[model samples]
Target chain A: SQTIHQWPATLVQPVGSPLSLECTVEGTSNPNLYWYRQAAGRGLQLLFYSVGIGQISSEVPQNLSASRPQDRQFILSSKKLLLSDSGFYLCAWTRQGGDGYTFGSGTRLTVV
Target chain B: QQQVKQSPQSLIVQKGGISIINCAYENTAFDYFPWYQQFPGKGPALLIAIRPDVSEKKEGRFTISFNKSAKQFSLHIMDSQPGDSATYFCAASPPNNNDMRFGAGTRLTVKP
Candidate 1:
């Protein structure tokens, strides 16, 4: 069975501070990984997705970026945090040409 | 058309009742429909899914009804319980595409 791990279940960051959230999947190789952000009223929105190492696609341009350093490791980072950047961040993985996705526990970041 | 429209931003239901959420899409290329459930401060998980080849698919108390011609699909939760109270999202994906489009999400509350 595959499992995903996300660090810092909850985070509080000052505006203009740097942000880094890491997610890694176990038991899968070269899986399709995605980063999503869920707002209070808005549903989950795709922020970024990576098909392979060094390949990332941004669904919506904002103060965020994603990188797949290793086949199973994905990281979401921001040069500086913004008040609007606060939300529930999630990491998900699915097999290529697969049916469903498996998501991590998620991290709740609050920008104060 | 890459958008998915969902209805009933929020719902309130009594325990033991049935809960239904609907979604529609304009992309005929989307053949895979999935539903996800998310609890407060948690990541969304796949609840149920179906393909256009089938009109309906059920897993335990959850069911997904897909209307291929209408380009619509819905999620049904039978015997709703307080534990089932969460936000539900409908998503559609094209077989050849790597990205999936998610609905706005419906917040369901089951009063116990």
Candidate 2:
């Protein structure tokens, strides 16, 4: 079975600070990875997706960026965080030609 | 532009009742329609999915109805339980498209 692990499960960052969230999938190789953010009471916004190592696609321009450093490892980072950056961040992975995605537990980021 | 649209931003249903959520898409090329369920602080999980070639697909208590001509789809939950309370999102993707577009989520509360 495939499993995705994301951490820290919860984060509290001060405004203007840097941010880093990591997600790694086990039991799958060459899976497509995605990063999504959900604001309170709002729909999810796609931030980035990676098809392969060193290949990242940006969906919406914002303060965040994503990277696929390894085949199974994906990282979401920001040089400086903003108050608006606070939200529930999710990591998802899907096999090539798969019907749907399998998601991680998620990271609750609170930028104060 | 938003390709997918979901209705009923919030829904409250009594236990043993039926809960229905609707979603419409503008893209005719979308061949896959999926519904995801998310809890308060967790990533959205794949609930049920239907392909355009099929009119309806059922899994346990959940069902997805797809309309190819209208480019619309819906999720229905039978005998709703409190555990079914969560946010639900509708998503669509073309056969060759790697990215899936998700609709604004609907928060469903099944009260026991």
Candidate 3:
């Protein structure tokens, strides 16, 4: 059974503060990983995706960046956060050539 | 521009009634269509999926109907319940493409 973990469950950061959100998967290796952001009462927006370690693709250019430090560890970071950067951040993984996606619990960040 | 389009931005249905959400895509290369269910402050979960090769696929109370000719797909929930009240997202992906495009999402409220 594959599972994804993301933390912290909720975050409150001041504007211009640095931010880091981590996600990890167990029971799978070399899986496709993705980062998404969802505005309140809105839809999911693709932020970044990685096919392998050190390979990250940005769907929308923003203040956020993603990195794959290990085979199953992914990190989302920002040097300076803005008020608009507050949203629910999600991490998801799927096997290569797979049908379904498994998503993490998500991180709700509120930029103050 | 959003690659996938979904309708009925929000829905309200009574329990035991049917809940239907529709999605359409313009990309002919998209062969896989999937639906996701999301609860407040949580990540979305894969609800059901269907391939263009099959017009309809059913699992439990969830059903996905794909119309290849119309470039449309829909999710139907029979005997809707309050527990089924959540936001639903529709997504489409081309073969070998790990980046799946998601719809704007529909908020379904199944009243008890």
lDDT for each residue of candidate 2 in A20-112, tens digit (9 for 90 to 100): 999999998999999999899899788899889999999989888898989999999999999999999999999877779888998999999
The lDDT ranking, best first, is: 3, 2, 1
TM-scores for the candidates: 0.96, 0.97, 0.98
Task: Give lDDT tens digits, candidate 2, residues B41-87.
Answer: 88899999888878999999999988888888999999999999999
What tens-digit string does per-residue lDDT give for candidate 3 at A67-90? 999999999999999999999999
In candidate 1 the C-alpha lDDT for residue A83 amounts to: 100
Candidate 2 to truth, TM: 0.97
lDDT of 3 at B103: 97
Weakest 10 consecutive residues of candidate 3 chain A by summed lDDT: A94-103
- Tell me how far the alpha carbon of residue A6 in candidate 1 is from the true structure, in angstroms, after superposition: 0.8
The superposed Cα distance between candidate 3 and the true structure at residue A11, in angstroms, equals 0.3
lDDT of 1 by residue, A7-110 (tens): 88999999999999999999988899999998876787899998889999999989998988999999999999999999999999998888777889999999
For each candidate, C-alpha RMSD in Å? 1.2, 1.0, 0.7
Chain B TM-score of all predictions, in order? Answer: 0.96, 0.97, 0.98
Stretches of candidate 1 off by over 4 Å are none
Best by TM-score: 3
**All candidates: TM-score of chain A:** 0.97, 0.98, 0.99
